[model samples]
Target: MAKDKKGTKKADSSASARMSNKDYLRELRRLHVEIVKLQEWVKNKGIKICIVFEGRDGAGKGGTIKALTERVSPRIFRVVALPAPTDREKSQMYVQRYLPHLPAAGEVVIFDRSWYNRAGVERVMGFCTQEQVVGFLKAIPLVERAIVESGVILLKYWLEVSPQEQTRRLEARIKDGRKIWKLTAMDLKSYSRWYDYSRARDDMFKATDTGHAPWLVADSNDKRRARLNIITDLLSRISYEEVPREKVKLPKRQAPGGYREPNYPLKRIAEKF
Candidate 1:
């Protein structure tokens, strides 16, 4: 990933050109096969893995997570996207709400947005005190160190999108019926506070980018390239070899001797498509 003078990562060169749907799907399906192998390896080896994805709105975090887990078993590769904290949750330790969602033995947990909320949204917005944000920045590294010590492999990714691209995507969401649900009031507010978010992100990377759990920056202006790059990088980090399985043979179906088909008519919904 390349960064400009501002220290913000620039989108990949490949993002300049649009990716055809055919090529995207072809490569995506190929990676999906590898993800299935990784899933099997994790389960067979009882590996504990946690992946944290944090980024600006419309930065393609959801899409990337969807691609990563779509072909894998949900039970083994779980996604945790916590909603706004309740009053009770707010009162607990800042990291406490996230701890319970950590990966157990043989499981991989992917957090759509993890505790770094204190560093990004919570701090940039008025949700948390500056002191609290500062405290979290100092303390989170220790928490992550403990997580790694407990035999869990932690990976953090920050998806970076240019300001123009982000605005375009946000506007597209407003017009696209399927994406309307993704555009929230908070997102609208966050849009205007770009510089605030940038400063917060810089401060966050400075404080929490530790030796144990460093941040991996992914340029998401071109979503297809970003997805492929992320998945490829992730797979490289985890040392997994495809686990051999006994060949599965479908047993022949038994013939129903003297069984008569029912002639009863049932109402069916008209096919709209």
Candidate 2:
């Protein structure tokens, strides 16, 4: 609730730091318990959850997703990140490319950057024709409407950072060599046109924010708080009854001694790479 003179979170060490030593242990226990319950709920109810995470590069979208799904079963919680279209994909409708990533009967499909790219960055970057951008914009509400009407629960998170903060992060990435590729030519061009993108982003909210698919602005200047908020909301949103922990099943090993044969001299090992 408190901020520094910069109006940034003073107590948050980083966008990705929230729980302390004691807090972390407690938080992990709570999160694990909830995840087990949610997994069972998914299996029983056959619920479908679709979440879209959109933000400028270096906004820690991937980091947030990691934290959120840390305790979740990989089989049920899927991260869908699309690569550039293949030649065949280029010929098909854009929406078709994303269908394989949609939630199964009882799964969560989190799209890193969705089809809405046409209305936001694509439009601002001239990657698509004016017709393409306009068409996507006009169709967004209807497209989401259809998805929800078809019984898919959707959540869209907009992770936002100050322009100055974005610049700092981009520069740091370039120095780090970890994610420099994300800062593409278009991104550099988009830099000078920050105002243009801002206008376009505002336009996106105005035109496509429908009743069924509402948008939540995530203050991602602090990654920890944002991820915490994002995951907490996700946990509560999916319709599920409380799952009795005692009713859950755990996979059992078939070893006769009730433990793995110890090939691992791990406890006595002292060698380091």
lDDT of each: 0.95, 0.79
TM-scores, each model vs. reference:
0.93, 0.79
Q: Show how many residue pairs clash in every candidate, following the order shown.
A: 0, 4
Tens-digit lDDT string for candidate 2 (130-162):
887777778878888988988899999989988
| Candidate 2 lowest-lDDT run of ten | 12-21
Question: Clashing residue pairs in candidate 1, if any?
Answer: none
lDDT of 2 at 266: 62
Choose the strongest candidate by TM-score. Answer: 1
Q: State the lDDT at 6 in candidate 2.
A: 90
Runs in model 2 lying further than 4 Å from the true structure: 1-29, 177-186, 245-270
